[model samples]
Target chain A: MSQAVADRQETEERQTVGGRFARLMDMGDGALAFWLLLPTAVLLLAIIVYPVCRLIYTSFLSLSLTSGLPASFAGLQNYRDMFADPVFWSSFWNTVIITVVTVPGALVVGMALALIANIPFRQRWAFRLALLVPWALPLAFCGLIFAWFFQSDYGIVNDVLRRLGLPTVIWFNSYAWATVAICLTTIWKTSSFMALIILAGLQTIPRSLYEAAEIDGAGRVRQFFEITLPLLRPAIAVALIFRTITALQTFDIPYTMTRGGPGTSTVTLAMYIRQNTVDFLDLGYGSALAVAMFALSMIVTVFYLRMIRRGA
Target chain B: MKYGKTVLLALAGAVSMLPLQNASAETLHVFMHSYDMNLWQAVFDKYEASHKGIDIKVTVGGNTSEQQAQYLNTQMSAKDSTLDIINLDVVRPAQFAAAKWIMPLNDDLDGGTKYLDRYLSAYSKANVIDGEVAALPSRADAMMLFYRKDLLKKYDIDPPKTWSELSADAKKIQKQEGGDLQGLSFQGAAIEGAVCTFLLPYWSTGHTLVDKDGKLTFDMDAAVDSLKLWKGFVDDGVAPKNVAEIATDDTRQDFQRGAAIFAVEWPYAWNHFQNDADTAVKDKVGIVALPAVEGGKSATCLGGWQWGVSAYSNHKKDAVELTKYLASREVSKYIAIHGSLLPTFEDLYTDADVTKAVPWFADLLPVVQSAHARPVTPRYNEVSNAIRTTVNAVLAGQTSPEQGASQMQARLQRILR
Candidate 1:
């Protein structure tokens, strides 16, 4: 009976020590998590939340530099004026067109490039590196180069077309074509980013699945649809989200190449905001437009997440 | 021990604060747009040589007028005393003046009249907003026609003296000396350059985009006729369709590459055209005034910068002195030699050395003497942007001149009100 009691006491002591050690480990993990997250939280609040809140507050007020005072409360007048402004509507439509045209187009081209780069070829590495060149180049520089290439009088593209006995089309003068040209520039500049993302997803797919598909008599096209695409859902969602958000905010290319020109056909929402705030010195209206843009981007994010979840 | 530690910490804090305090003293800061930095550098060099005790620091702010205005507004709103002097564009003086972000030189300074007498009367008057000289004109520039003399000689045609005659001549040259060479080229880009260089002809033709009362006045028959003439140039293959998107640099390169017989450009291109290493048409180029418009006189659009002392600046007096010195004829002539800036001073325009150095200035001086400033208003930037947008719309055929003009008028009315 004495030996039995001693063994039970020893077992209880071991159990107590193990339980205390587990609690201490848990506390350490909690501390580590707090340390890791504090900087990010502070940074987000400083860089993002504060600026957004300030912008929102500014939007509700009539601010003028000449007045030399804090912006006066103007209620919803700025928002009301925005809706009634035709230029705003035109720019809104242009932003929509750019988003619609560039997002899906970039995704498809990017996926195609990712697939080609994934394949076993002699020049696969070279092709992959070359694909990144456009995205790596500065947007302004690319715009300048494209401007030269599209010159109606002496641009190389026109020269080549003329040599082939084709009618030279002015790329920027025609209202419809200028938008297309801008969209093309956006696609060329951003597709490599999508490809890089999709390529990473492609790498994550198991080799065994393709082997199994081949054993099941699945053709290359069938394999792609069955094995590759279904597995690439997460990547596609991420890429589409990224590309859509960026495409909606397309400014530098159109601003540099077209300046929303040929009658504001290429003026995106961001361009309109810049013009109102900077060119016209209408800060109240510009802030309202910025708020609208932020709201639209948020709505797009929510819609994308819902669609992504449903697809998954 | 605790007291000793506290003392060390306090000493460290004081050391750190010392640099900040010293940074606040002795330096006079100036802000200017990127393109004007060359002229500013020369002026600063001269000022530094003259003022031994004071230091001048300069910052190049932005590339576009809009960018510059926005940056200045933000800095001034923040009450940044470091921004001591600002270089504003001539068209934008009223906007800055209305805000009172800049000092009124006429009230604060002596010898203002003598300084004012050196500039062209129109330019000097344009800087006067609300009965104060808000800024002083530093440099002046205007657009002129640059033609390939050899090409004209080869085609056996005279340089065009009128828009109609120019159109005819352009077509004749295009037909006779056939290659990829266009008869004429100008900025058609949907930027301010297009409105300045391209639409000035239309305005010169007795068409005004905005009336003196600030109403949209772009839909007159003369304006439509002007648009049709521009379109005809494109249609007849005298001007390229892509000219609508050409930038200033792109247009310059096209002219340099011998792609066009005539180029409508600013005086900045004269040095490039004269330098044999930089241009193919070095000796073959000739400069002339823009052709007259039908039933109206030829008008050149004024392009230049003005110097203003910032209200936020603690060194306002020094800034004013610097501006006055920069605007003096001696400094203006030095700038003309070093930076190729067209002298804003009338005396410098007549200087024999300047005439010899930039012979084209002899032709451009008369043009500048009669150059037209864009409407002088506090909202000139907005007005100019609206004009550019409307003209671009008309040129692109997205909207008729009437519709665009009407829309612009409506927008301007709202802005004015």
Candidate 2:
């Protein structure tokens, strides 16, 4: 009997405390909003803000695993070393090149595929399913598949070229062709995702606009240029921003296909960071590299936001 | 009230059973690469079957040594205690010992130096650090020349002992075969094998990459000659035009499929050639020490795996016991017969069962005895990268041999100093 009474008293006390907190939240709308967002703010701090701060802090130290020396403060030394390193410059340029080439390449391919899929057909679900397949494939798997396809001796591309009475190209051995191959693969893997996003934008365009344009004698090409392109700007912007960010961080495809070979010509900044942190076990230098990558991403994202705001 | 009491009693029972279950079977986790997982799993199962109340859990790692090292290094650096035993590549024991990630095994073994006499001297020496045994050799490997025995006999040519003769023989065979048959296939890609590829010819010039003290003692002219020799093969149509893209497995695949007349590969390819279902070169393959540079001695690179007990393992004593069993001559002979993995023990090389399984093991003793290890230093990865990238660059026609050698020297000097 005494245990039952104690449990009831504890339950009532908890209810009263919760009720008091709820009443306190009801004092103002601003306070209610703050209370509602506290959990998310706490989570974001724990996951993102804490790690970023640690990364920045570690970047200012000299922590080399192979050296067998204790870590010591070395302000700006890693950054100084990075600026003087030729490999860093080369990898940075390669990352920029990947972003510049693949983003526009995917956009064009994706636009065509999106328009094709938007056509009214009875079996439209099949077309939609096909669009999802490549987008759903793993990046590393795509890299491996394309690597086999582009192999010098027995690759299907060279085989086809041989059958066509053309000279076959060595895909992965040459710097120019290796970069082209990885860029081509990145476009192929990512274009379908862009297509899916644009398809959603295509659905929002009312049929009445196309109908009015058709009645006004506007050709298919003209209507597409004016109406479709104009109406799809927002979706394209979103896809471009997302794709550009990912392109700057490209690692898996090139890693699987070339492993940053041919004299490290295809190495991206992310791969350089991996080589430093994981391969060489130079945490301080790798953290600095990461901070540079983070800054690059932030600048690119901010530029896109500004452009979007201005366009709006 | 009665229901609540019963629920509490049930929770207490479940909590108490956890310790009982743990006490019944002590689990030891062993991590190794996926390539040897099945064969090693059999050994683990044998150990588990013999030892009651002990459960052995195996974790398979990546395909490449570099990949496995990266994964293990990350885990060990974080002091992860989950992995009780680790299999390290031959090049990594020194680095792991320097970092104190692996425990010294002298205390566990019976005055460990006594047991060292059972294995090949070079491999056994690789595990000893500061008069303490840091690891025990599990298997041994070395680069060798793999040729089509049928083709050599058809041409009435003996296995070439010099690089020029080998090249001449390869070109002659290519001319005779006459239809898209590549003369040679070797790993020229920027990877771990490329380091051995660079070191093979360089070592033939009677130069050690690093002195016994782990100090750089590189010979630039010899390095240039080594670079030029590999580049010449590609340039003169002796090797594939895109040989720069070929990795270790690529050469293995090419040789196994009979696409190449000669290949430089590890001993593992011998097993595949003799046994694999898809091999076209079955009963047609021959192995020899890699061809020497003219007027220089023949040398091949040493490679093997080792067993190390993790410093962070809670069950260190049990892990060392398991390591001993795995490294025993009995287990080594079983692996030699079953998996065709070269045993580290000298007697196993001459064991009747092993010799019957791998007939060439009788001649392999000299090669294994003289094989050179890569530069043993904590900065070995950087050293390896420097050499491999230079080799790749020279082979890909991106840099001249002279330029690549100088560049490699500059990079290695900076790293080593």
Candidate 3:
């Protein structure tokens, strides 16, 4: 009872900051609240907001590294050039396609892995480690390992296919296959992360509820559908949003495997921006593309958040 | 109050001159990449030993051309006076010269810059853009065609002298030798090497990206035929099917793996092919210039490095003298013998000492003689990117050679304008 009291007091102290913020906000104590938020607000303004605003500002200028002239404001001409660039559209589509394929694929696989890992197996901890190994590997190492597996000449993937009398395809040789290969590599690396998050959500469900459903003559599938999934919605939503953002910003696997080659089929917007900014030294244009990407990501994230809120 | 302020100002000025008197060391900050660091350090030490109150402070970048470009672009564009000299790519002299980032060497190069005449004409001419010798030729490299002498002898064939003959022999060899051995391998990835490989045919056929007047002289017919030949190398299953994805390093490794009959590579591959210990074709390999295009002139893509003084350098005299010393015959000979680099000096090609150290330097002379530098334009980055994309598209089979040529024309127009 004393420990419970201590816990309640601790919770209250945690809430004191929140409560003070709410009360201060409600009572129109603008000065006090501003003073309280000064550090955080300044940090955000400098670190995050300033760079973004600079990028947006740079987007409207003509800055060339190879030239001696000072930068002049072009005012949406960079945007116009971006839209006119076919390479930009191709990279945009590549990012979209990779996200569309990898997110759902990871989710489904992750859900299955989470369920399997949650089963009453004797070596469940060992199984968990086995499943988590892919996520543990660094993303660059994962890309290189996958590249070796899918390498056309002597890679084990093709070797297995050839042994099985299946026609082997050159993995990173075409627009379609290179995109597919990148997606596969990304999904393999990221699904473990999704599973770890979803598994945590699965552990939070009350055991009594499942037992009661079992006693009420509910089949395994019915119990899963009725008791498990509905309660798991928040976890799935969180996982989905996290994975989607990561997938949208995909760079490592594609860049490492293909270097945006085979005719720029696997280049994400990140790669395109890098090529323009660093490789081509077109900083102004690259920053414009970066700003556009940020805006698109924001819109998508908002849409996803709204959908999640409605679903819950 | 005015008298007191004047006294304070005089004291401050006198105080500022104290450090100037104590440390009057003149430092030349040299920007270079470590192709041969030991040789550079030794040369710097030798120079610093002879000259007092002058030190050569070297800044080294790792061997990524991108990093070099970024470093120079950042430092030079800001007009930073700290960097006194730059070891730049041969192809970049025009761009840097046009932008006034690197200084012209006319007044400093040994009284009228007569040292330029001692270097190979092709490489020396590469440094001169718009009547200004903006850079000093520091090193020389050219493409060489390496082939298996044993395979040619076994197949009862002479070395090919033209593209048609080369393709015909490659097809026959592939038919007889089976799929275990690929006929040819070359860099076709959308990077710089692709341009080098593609340039052989394009320039051999006497096609230049720009005319003598610097106008875009993109000939569609020659470009299509050139690209068609490249695509045919893959389509006919002589080169690897995934040739579109191979970089220069991959080409070297593939050839080293004894997986290809012939490979187009730079002079750097010679030592690796002979002495890498794992090379199965160590004694079996021989090199020749790339085959001509039947009716076209013989051509090879020249590649190397050049040294230039920074326009914003504080010690311009020291920087220029340092460049001259770095490219001196002693240094070039040392680089050639020790670093496996081709000396930029024309006389070193026939030097008995160099030939004693490396027997194959003799054969490289004719290839270097006829070698053409890639288009010397201020818009080289844009132009090269456009060509790389077009040729890469053809290699990927995304577009036909003719279509790629048309795309090239469009992109070149937008950029050249």
Total clashing pairs for each candidate: 1, 0, 0
Residues A260-302 of candidate 3: C-alpha lDDT, one tens digit per residue: 7776657889888987776566788899889878977998899
Specify the highest-lDDT model's number. Answer: 2
Q: Which stretches of candidate 1 lie over 4 Å from their true place?
A: A1-53, A64-70, A114-169, A188-220, A226-228, A278-281, A309-312, B1-50, B54-80, B111-118, B146-161, B205-219, B248-261, B275-288, B333-366, B393-404
lDDT at residue B235 of model 2 (Cα atoms)? 82
Error of 2 at A296 (Å): 0.9
Candidate 2 chain B lowest-lDDT run of ten: B109-118
lDDT of candidate 3 over B1-417, digit per residue (tens): 999999999999999999886667788998898665786788789888887677888898656555587677767767889888898887899889888999988877565545578888887788887777798878899988888888899999888888888888888887888866888898878877787776789888888878776788888888888899999989988888778878777888888888888898888887788888888778888888889897987788889988898999888887888888887888899878876789888779889989987888988888888888887876677778778767777898877888778877877776676
Model 1: how far residue A203 lies from native, Å: 5.5
Whole-model alpha-carbon lDDT for candidate 1: 0.79
Worst 10-residue lDDT window, candidate 3 chain A: A19-28
Query: Which candidate wins on DockQ?
Result: 2
Taking all chains together, the TM-score of candidate 2 against the true structure is 0.85
By summed lDDT, the worst window of 10 consecutive residues in model 1 chain B runs over B214-223
Give DockQ per model, in order: 0.33, 0.45, 0.29
Please, what are the lDDT tens digits per residue for candidate 1 over residues A170-196? Answer: 787766877877778888888899999
Give candidate 3's error at residue B397 in angstroms: 4.0
Candidate 3 is graded, for docking, as: acceptable
